[model samples]
Target: MSDLEKKVKQFIDRHKLIQKGSSVLVGVSGGPDSLALLYFLNKHKEMYDITLTVAHVDHMLRGKQSFEELLYVKNICKDWDIPFEGVQVNVNEISKESSSSIEVIAREVRYDFFQSVMKKRNISTLALGHHGDDQIETILMRLTRGSELKAAAGIQVKRPFATGTIIRPFLCVTKSEIEDYIKMNNLIPVYDHTNEEDIYTRNRYRNHILPFLKSENKNVHIHFQQFSEQMLEDEFFLMDLAKKTYNKVVSKEKNGDLTLNLIEFRKAPFPLQRRCIQLILNYLYNGELPKDLTSIHIDSIFELIDKTKPSGQIDLPQNLKVYRSYDLCVFTFHVQTKKPYFLNWDKGKTLELPNGRQLFMKEGSVPDDIGQNIFILDENTEFPLYVRTRKNGDRIRIKGVGTKKIKSLFIDLKIPHNERDVWPIVTDQEDNILWVPGLRKSIYEASDFTTGEKVILQYK
Candidate 1:
């Protein structure tokens, strides 16, 4: 057996990615990596007791070159007596419609097409040609971009796909090894010109970063791949513990909100806490992590949990909010456009805000121990109190200071851009801003508080 075949077999046996008598669908892009996978799998099909089928996706970004590559894959499959399936998609249009990058949309389309072919062919596994070098690139990318232990685990060897499994048999091999195998077999593999361009992040890593790293350490690829393997094992163990902790401490509400028991959640280690947060988010999001939830978000959650305050809230990606109310920490998915909210609050009544928070008004004295949730204003200031979201040109005057724009205050507080629009702004009947929730109180009329009548605003 050839070295490529031996490595492929060893990888399959080690990962148990393929079963005997299983039908496999190979993604063939006509590039060296994929072509090599197709060739090797076909050569060893009988030995593995498998049948081979090839799937190709034409991204339509390269004009005629796209069709040429599709023909190349089709003819090669014909030559090898393997079934060929190809689909055409306008990746540019899809990218624009989905607001995603061309590379991301193209990969999505490719995988969707591959799964459709797999279903039609009754294939139990779809094999891709991601090798050790690709794994190194993925790890370095996530590392430079700030990743957690699970993200550092890099590309998995085998993951569940549409109806079967997606396997990467060449992850144990390198690009040079695959090239050597192709040369030994006198194979002609097409090259993708786009890959040679360093515009893309992966290409930059492949063309520039990997070379520089190799100069310092000759075995950098192997070392990084080994590191990924080690990290993956650690990730799995932590995830298992997190899953158990999630079942114990997490409760789903009738309205799809997830509440984590703070008593139990705070007792867990920091690592499990992070994973538990991620696991709950994935569960609430239908088994997928929100793309915007980062390590920073997770760390911020830990910080919030450690705080001595009775109630606090933090904004997360995808309009999700993690808030501590009394003894429970809740994760709420609020995906709605911010609309101007105007409500009138009578003394001793509760006013609802646009974000589902309530502000209770009561006739009381200004207590010396008033906390952040309490706002004291003159009761005779206005008859009907008003509450609304921020609007353009909204300015508030500080005590003994000039008027400042609410936007500037938000910038000073380091409020994220997405949360600023929906942040509640409390105003009087005359439209004088009184308080900004979770932020500063107006203090605009501090001198006017000499009156005996005062109304206390408490947030709930």
Candidate 2:
């Protein structure tokens, strides 16, 4: 076999990225790196029992030139008898709507298109052309941005993606090797103008930082790649330990709140403690760690835990709040809205809450089956049904008990104070609490059983 094929096969075997008879989808952009990847994989498909397909995404920014690139990739796939699929997206429109830069939007749209193709084709593996050079650039970028050790691990060789796995077979190979392979095969590859422009951060790193480092050490890319691999090993160990620590001390509430047992948290090692905090933020943000959660933010959390005061709090990114009240440290997103969410109860349709939650109200007898979020309103209710957060002077008539303030009820339930501000409440026109989801039902004894028409309120 050829040198390029040998190197690629070794990398794939080392990473165990592709199993026998794996159906692979290649993300090709008609560039040198992608074309080189397509060539190598196509030549070795029979040996590996691999089925190959290519996906191309046009950002629609370069107009005719963009279409030309897609056509170029299509022609190449045709010569190899591989399936080729392409899509065009209005990146400018997406950027405006998302309030993000064109570069960020383009990356998101590109990956989205790749995932769609994987799903449509039932491919089990998605291969990309990221090389050692890209890894070095990423590490340098993370270093300058004050990222943590995990961020410094750079691009992974394989990661879960779109019902399968994303493998970077060329991660161990350098850009120089790719160019050499293309030259040896007498093939031409298209160049993207955007790579030459220094406006983007990656381009700046490629054009300036990498060259400077290469001057200091001729094999700087190899050195950086080795360093990143070591970091990845250490990161994996720390992450595993952190996950175990999290399971032990962290308690997750149904209402998107996380509580850390402060007594137990303080006993763990410092590394686990820091990772625990990171995990909490990631959980609150739906597995995406907040970008602004820096070392400073983490240190502040430790400081809050050390404070002598029984109750202390610190604000975090994305409207998140971390506070310690006696034995529990709560991590929650307290959305402080100048205008509270007030909506008239619509029994026919679902009411969309601020944070992707939904409120459903229906007029019927209580359903035999119910979830934690479901509540029942008395059929003889005399007041109008409205949904909003707690307001001062709000009172609820607890079932089998006398009237109590909402504030007192929250305290009695040990609900994190930070979450109480945004905790949704369903109230009647007289401002009487009908139901506090996952907590209690109304005590207003109304004889609704005669008609048996109940207003069922559910938050999901």
Candidate 3:
């Protein structure tokens, strides 16, 4: 067996990247990296005791070239007697809608389509041909773009993906090694013109920094491997620390929201505390940690806790707001811009929430139309509704009960600490909260939609 084949097989055995008799979905772009991956893995399929199929997604941006590439991939799979699946999508429209870069959109589309194939065909692993050199490019780019420790961390050799698992056996190899393997095997790989265009940031690094560094260090490829190894090790340590610290201060509610105990977090080391915060935020916001977040923002947040200015607030980019609440610090991500979690509470009728949800108001009884359920409010109660994040002074009146502090109510209702503030609260003009949207409406403003003429409520 070839050295590349042996190394890949060893990684697979060590990590259990693939299972015997398991269906593997290959994410092939027909590039040198992917081509080499497919060839080597296919050659050793019998030894690995795995069934393999190739999946290709054509963004159709390159027009005929993309189609040809897809066709080439299909033919290659045919030659190997492996199943081939191809999908074509207009990522242009998707990019605009998702507000994602073309590369990001392509990645999502590819994974989504591949996941569909996986479900349809019962495939377990989505294998990609991302080599060690690609990991270096990512690290360099992230470091240049001002990244945090978590952001600068290198890729994992194997990850538990949403569908099943994603493995990159080629990560142990380099781009040059893959190209060499392709040439040795007389492989025909598709060329992505975009990689050379330097239009995107990665191309910029590949063109400018990588070559220059390569000249400076004859064995720059080896240097990339070393860097990835070190970064990978550092990443594991931080993540492990984050995991341990997260368990110390974090708990999840029945509703699936996570609670982070600031009181407990206050005791841990700064790095573990920060890592825990990043982990929670990353899961909530989903995908790549905030790039623009600076040491200044981090310090400012600490100041909120440090200087006893718990009531202070700071707004970071991407509609993320950080506030300190005396006992705890809260970070809220306003997921939607235009909506802004608006709820206009009127005297009589129903007040609709932003999420196509209705908060019905009637004089006496609860409505039968309870998909999301409705809230009752009375005219003698609070007026001119205000919706905002949970504040230190926040309080709520439990139905059939007296009153409770927001923090106590959080413990009572099992509201997660991390989510307590970010949870939208509807308050009257006097700052008296009328309802904790989707949870409860204030007893003071309990309504039956009888007093007001129309259902006057603002929804996002």
Please provide, for model 3 over 1-460, each residue's C-alpha lDDT reduced to its tens digit, 9 standing for 90 to 100: 7777777777778777888877788999999998888888788888878889899998989878888989999999899898999989998878777866888888888888988999999888889999877877888887877776755766667777766899988877767778888988999898888789977888898888877876787566556666766777787788898889888887754433455577888898887887887776776567665657677876776676677543556776677776555565556663422324455655555654443344444344344453213444454555555666666667777667877787776666655344554566777777776667666656655445544433333222
lDDT of 1 at 457: 79
How well does candidate 3 score on lDDT at residue 32?
Answer: 94
Which regions in candidate 2 have their CA more than 4 angstroms from the true location?
335-460
Query: Model 2: per-residue lDDT, tens digit, 214-332?
Result: 78987776777778878898888998999999999999876777888988888889988888877887778788766667788888988889888767789888878887877788787
Indicate the TM-score of model 1.
Answer: 0.71
Cα error, residue 4 of model 2, in Å, equals 3.3
TM-score for model 3?
0.67
lDDT (Cα atoms) of all candidates against the true structure: 0.81, 0.82, 0.72
Instruction: Tell me how candidate 1 scores on lDDT.
Output: 0.81
lDDT of 1 by residue, 218-255 (tens): 76766777787788888899999998889889998765
**TM-score winner between candidates 2 and 3:** 2
> Model 1 Cα displacement at 144 (Å)?
1.1
Q: List the residue pairs that clash in candidate 1.
A: none
Top lDDT: which candidate number? Answer: 2
Q: For candidate 2, what is the TM-score? A: 0.73
